[model samples]
Target: MTEILEPENCFCQLASGSKGNALYVKGGETAVLFDCGLSGRELERRMAERDLDPTTLSAVVVSHEHTDHVGGAGVICRRFGIPLYITEATRTGSTKKLGKTKAMDIQAMECGKRFSVGSLEIHPFSISHDAADTSGFRVTASSGAVLGIATDLGIAGHLVKEHLSGCHALVLESNHDPELLYANPNYPWPLKQRVRSRVGHLSNEEAATLLDAIDRSRLSHLVLAHLSEENNTPDLALAAAYGVLNGSNTSITVAKQNLPTPVLSF
Candidate 1:
């Protein structure tokens, strides 16, 4: 056996769903906010609940311009004196949601480009989503630990698998169950169609199918995220994933929309 030195990468979903989304990822001395969909005050409260310090954040990286992903991006960056990392298209699309932000504090990041934030290296890849230039992030710690995040994406194709492959931990979306989504009386026909569209969200079965395509031999942590409160249940999401990951030695969790998941390390 060999001794390892560098710290393992760790992450937690502060909140995830249609209402809001946010996550914190840390690798060694580097810590970053992957999204800040909640208000600055609420995001800080969630961090506090998890014993994480917002002052230590290196940057706030946005995945897209959607309100559920970028609503609090500007406030969090400003409050913590951290830089805001976003693609140019996303920056333009988020103008209103991000509110006022210092031009100098914003760093432009293109999809498929790699960027550094302290000891962590981030690779952003494009994803199928309705938002402007949505991305799925692959974060690698200096020690070679990898954390993959691919939530809020509609289609998980070869590219998604390529980016998600070999991850130690993954936060993937399992948005809804087709039966429930289709049967919901509150949702109109158009809304149902949109929910299952190519650029909408992943159903539980679709998530399971996508998981089967990705490499999970070394995967230790898997969190199913962005579940619909109205259309899906944690049990349904977990059941779908369990079928694909049957008897696998992996810790699976269903992320909540309002509460933070416990910190998961790789």
Candidate 2:
């Protein structure tokens, strides 16, 4: 009989905020990065800290064209010469902002199709947002472990809920609290309404409610991502999910805008 090493699959947030966002996923010797929002230098520094080399990264996937998500995409693609993957809508918007130089490397992805990269199966599912075309993803590793990544949705519909069920780990958005948004002194009325709109961002309560509806039996790690700087706080987001998660056996962590949380192994 031979002792077998369990397959290693992990996800880590490189950055998440109004400024920029990225998530790095690795399994075995094959690794795929989901987004590249931070600058190439910053991305290099983070990768080095994790003992990862950017040149060895398999591919870079884009969620949408928002500056916070695609700001550093071009830089990463250019620096490493990695193929950039995105939907046609995302490519159009990215082209306008990131320019033709970066857009040249983009490989368009079908929103509902599941594609393969090394040993990881990448599925890009549609997510409701103000952007032209945005998606959440489910990456199934060769070891049979699944990781669900979703963010920047105004509401999680049947499509979103059904796709996210029974995942080993998740990076879900808990962007803001409704009350906090209303009382916040900075945002004007129109901007505030947009933030609370169905096409805008999800409130902390919404995120919590979605978690409650999810089948948590197989859930190991749940990370609350994309908090608003002015309108949300970690304590409040934690409190929103605390009640539902109190008796449930699951580990919850908050993803900071500035600091990287420890890589979660699945």
Candidate 3:
């Protein structure tokens, strides 16, 4: 049987939020999924809405073992017969969450190592997050287009800034607003503390500060993702990032929890 390939140098945010997070990236004939947080059914539906065919996916690469990042991984791999890539620690920690499922190919990846999926080269780097062995990726296509992704991390440090330096597009986290998160009465004290910790998610201000440290000379598109539904609004996140990127030619968009962003191509 022959398989049709997806378009070259394209990226899309299937879903992004505290609710779930998934991203689709295709370079040449190879298509890879960054995370599968949505249920299998929901993920499939959203991909279809974007005219993407799951069967064409080359692999499902995981950033961490958190439920919001790995919940739908098992089902998606089982259904599409695609390989699942993650660090050994993440695989071990997520065993219970991933559950038992039909046999599928699993590949262990190491942080700071570069790997290839068809014509796309992926470099995974360690990130600071609560999950075991969380990673941020820099994917460069055969066409020389680079897409850098750094979500679920509390801070974007020197390593992250270095990897994301020359990206053409970026999907960065703007998880919350400190003021809104602190004022939200629904969240308990410990939860708030965790969110504000060094290993927790990045607030809007933190994300903007990280952007300030990075080189955006070649950056054309920036998508703010993994927003907190309770403490962050699209307008707020957009404003923070827009403030930092005011002089650049980069196009900005805030990813939605319930919808997929438009397919961005380079």
Candidate 4:
């Protein structure tokens, strides 16, 4: 008798090392990319190391048009003719920077809509941020496992919390510590105020508070992401989130700036 192999649920941080963020999720043969924040060569090298073939990617879902988030998007899209998905507002903004491509290749999804990319179901929720049409996503794998991707958000909103409530894994933001940002010498007063506002980035406290609001019973993995290079340290972010976890069974890790995190299995 022939034996059947079980498929594993895996998520890899391709560029979660520093200011930039990108992730790859695989459920059996169906692979979906979360963000393309690195250069094409770097992304290629990293994927190769993981034994992933770029042509096998199902689709690319973008969160926003920040250069760090979309740097390698154009290259990958054109290279494989992959479907690029985002909101209409984000698509418009992307065109302003990326220029017109094959319109047929762009899949425009409305906020709060649930859609499928291969075997994965994606739910895009609106987030408060300075960018136009910023969003976070919840992905449901074929195995019924759920993963939430949220970063570069200002404060957690009703939608974000509701969608993120029951995920098995979450890539949540821990952008900066309030004290570190306020004490930074490089930022001007206006920029400092912007960072502190509800429409700007989430502070470590805000990230922790968001976690506090969630139901932690089923929370398996929580990765602190999109940390500020100048204003935040991994130790501080870890400490704050650890305090929030308060000795819960949930596991936590600080996504590093230069090294890709191992594919976390659920």
TM-score of each: 0.96, 0.94, 0.96, 0.92
- Point out the worst 10-residue segment of candidate 2 by lDDT: 96-105
Better of 1 and 3 by lDDT: 1
- Model 4 is weakest, by summed lDDT over 10 consecutive residues, at 95-104
Show the colliding residue pairs in model 2. none
Off by over 4 Å in 1: 1-7
RMSD of each: 3.4, 3.3, 2.8, 2.9
What's the lDDT for candidate 1? 0.91
Q: Give the least accurate 10-residue stretch of model 1, judged by summed lDDT.
A: 1-10
Clash totals, every prediction:
0, 0, 0, 4
Query: Candidates' lDDT values, in order?
Result: 0.91, 0.84, 0.90, 0.81
Tens digits of lDDT, candidate 4, 130-237:
888998988888889989888877789888889889889989989898888889999898998998887788888889899989877778888888888889998999
Candidate 4 error regions (>4 Å): 1-7, 17-19
Residue 59 error, candidate 3, Å: 0.3
Model 4 residue pairs with clashes: 17-256, 17-257, 17-258, 18-257
Runs off by more than 4 Å, candidate 2: 1-7, 100-104
